[model samples]
Target: MPAITAENPLALPRVAASPDRAAARPVLAVTTAPSGLEGEGFPVRRAFAGITYDYLDPFIMMDQMGEVDYEAGEPKGTPWHPHRGFETVTYIIDGTFVHQDSHGGGGIITDGDTQWMTAGSGLLHIESPPEELVMSGGLFHGLQLWVNLPARDKMIVPKYQDIRGGTVKLLASQDGGGLLRLIAGDLGGHAGPGATHTPITMIHASVSPGAEVTLPWRADFNALAYGLAGSGSAGAERRPFRMGQSVVFGDGESLTIRADAAQDSRSANFEVVLLGGLPIREPMAHYGPFVMNSHAELAQAFDDFQAGRLGTIPAGAA
Candidate 1:
């Protein structure tokens, strides 16, 4: 739960949005994420499961990777894999991970850090718990979001960005009841660090008990708020939501969230990841790790990857 914090939220820049504002958005849908196993047996909850792409255009999928506390020698990780035509944003809320890719991009992803990898053409990569964590065991919680590339930039180039938690812009609610971490994109004319090929806004907010957080949102971008911790309600409609749930918002200029008066010991407040992205509206042909525009492109990607055209494993590495 240590994904950036402030001793006094009131000291941070504030974003003003009133609950009674005429622009308050309404909740269109509330869905519970289904849990499953992923990448060498790590537990995951598919945040976009059962949600239509129309509501998530410019974004492919999202996985909430673990809130698990593993015992020694029990941690798991993903083997080498390939991806192309999109970007993968791996954000660690707790714990650490080491990632390596064929393009020579490698680093330790620590708590409250983000690894933004753009697999424009194609590349092979791996994500694993650090050896120390695997040996000693500890808490691991994170999220991996797949952002789709438009057809034009689908083959531009491959790149990576390491965004540290401290570098993100922190914002507070007008009443100081909520703390917001701006990871990527723009809010209230303030921009985040991670630059995206697509237009989108990524934020992590913690709302105090019985507190309300109202945020001004871009009217053109589709809005979403995924519950990461505690119980709360979303929208002016007041649909109740809790941990591991995703809320799809209808047209609006602002979002409203209220935390319950009482919360479990798991967290002190209602935590949520707010995402808003302009719809790409392009035909999407996706399979496995490749997201292309058509079946022919998909076949070509497979052929390219099989022939090692994507990339090779680093020397002396698995």
Candidate 2:
């Protein structure tokens, strides 16, 4: 029960939904990704085409995965793009990437690193392969998420957070192998180093087979879980979850997960990224990589980018 005061716009305290708990609804209405789509003379890698869990409010979209298999050498990656009125958070698990932004703040995010970027107001950025890594048929893997900015902060200056593995703390069950890595927000009375201007929480949890873990949730918020590896059951009715799948919990008490562990086989080893937050009930008009409240605003962002008014590359343009 972390306390989230009204003044703390970024704090997402847990509040239990009512007892009646609306009928259990599908956490993810639909899942889609940008995979198999041709991009700049390359065949999109299968790993990069992630199944989305688009249930959280104020959060417009999500890409639950990305992978770089050097063996394929199919230049599987996303080219540079522009964005506005939102934030992008990339969490690396098994690979690496180079992030360059219009603000001039960019860097290489190795495995176990979390890169949180705020494309406030407007910014042009790209996440592509580094010749050295891509040439080796580098085995790259990670996730990219999009968080919406409130109307007021939509035009603020862009910012970035590169949280390395050592900097992020982990909590595990005393009796079970279930473990939780706090990427952002607070959990078990502990706060992560990944600072955020928005009220959001993202946690990466790995549960051992036959282990059950319960996570607290806020009544006023929406929750989603992306299953990376392994299979398990979650949410009401104990729905089945498999790799490349996601589960969204309707307004409820909390999330209870149980991973399978059959003898003589790799215990149900699974990686799940859980996210939740309060929503911004504003209109959303999106074009390309930019998401604004109106079509007019989206148009203006493109115009500004072409006009070169975004200011000479900021201090750390990677």
Candidate 3:
């Protein structure tokens, strides 16, 4: 197996769906997003982050916040933690994430900024805490996703990609009403700036109410959408979906979205995170911050951390 690194990067390939796969019954799988409870003294609500092939393959867990107000000089984000054999993608919609790590990568994910970190072999990092999640009574909103690394590249060094909002490229919908930012790979003619080793595509889209956007898809991979705002209907059944909900598409040729203008009174536009990639059906064994195929690999990662075989440490903050 090739080791994970800049040269031998680990990523899953994307395959278009075959006609037979596309002809399968259209399943509008709707799994209620889980909410985070009191853990580690932090109260979080989990809306759409988890490990499930029916949703996002090779991707585990999704966390979100509506808005947060930080007190002057107070930490309002996650503290230093260790992770192995996976990647963390942070998309900031409101507030900022003062980030630092032990693998020579660090930065702040301000509003509309994205922080993509790869903890291949091992790395210790922290997302600085924000102050007030419930401001004078406002909500905090954003997303955090975990994507698994392939077995061959689980022990690679850690890296970071801090993508500013304006810097990410956007593509127009067919009707020119909605916009999409391709964060990982090419979507139509649009491509994001983040460096990726896998054949994956993470897209953020903004669609006006009553608008419809169709995305070409294939069966070799799984695709899903996170409803950021407003509400809509998707798939063949046209099931109703609202904010804080997610819709998954089975192996098919394309994804069609229909906006809900009735909900425009609450929100006129909707935000979505469309993520899909080829599935890696390998056995998965996971601990708090580590993921591997077996108990032995997980133990080895812990041993390496204790023995300091992973790599170098991060430098001063920005």
Per-model tally of clashing residue pairs = 0, 6, 28
CA RMSD (A), model 3: 8.0
TM agreement with the true structure for every prediction: 0.98, 0.81, 0.81
| Ten residues in sequence with the least summed lDDT for candidate 3 | 1-10
**Candidate 1 per-residue lDDT over residues 40-143, each given as its tens digit:** 99999999998999999988999999899999999999999999999999999999999999989899988899999999999999999988999999999999
What's the residue-level lDDT of 27 in candidate 1? Answer: 92
Off by over 4 Å in 3: 1-25, 37-43, 48-51, 68-75, 129-140, 264-266, 306-318
Across 68-152, the per-residue lDDT of candidate 3 in tens digits comes to 3334443345656778998888887766556777766777776578899888878877775444432333333467887888888
Residue 173 in candidate 3, Cα distance off native in Å: 1.4
The clash number for model 2 is 6
Candidate 1 clash figure, as a count = 0
Model 2 / residue 46 / CA error / Å: 11
lDDT of 3 at 146: 78
lDDT of 2 by residue, 1-318 (tens): 011112222232332223454334335432323354433443332321343324556666666444445564544556566778888888877666787877778888876888999889877787766777656765656777888888788899988988887777666643445667778886657787787777777887777778766666666678777676677778656777755666667776467666766422432366677787877777777677787888888888888878876544555433
Candidate 1 Cα lDDT to native = 0.92
Off by over 4 Å in 1: 18-22
Residue 187 CA error for candidate 1 (Å)? 1.0
- The window of 10 residues in a row where model 2 has the poorest summed lDDT is 1-10
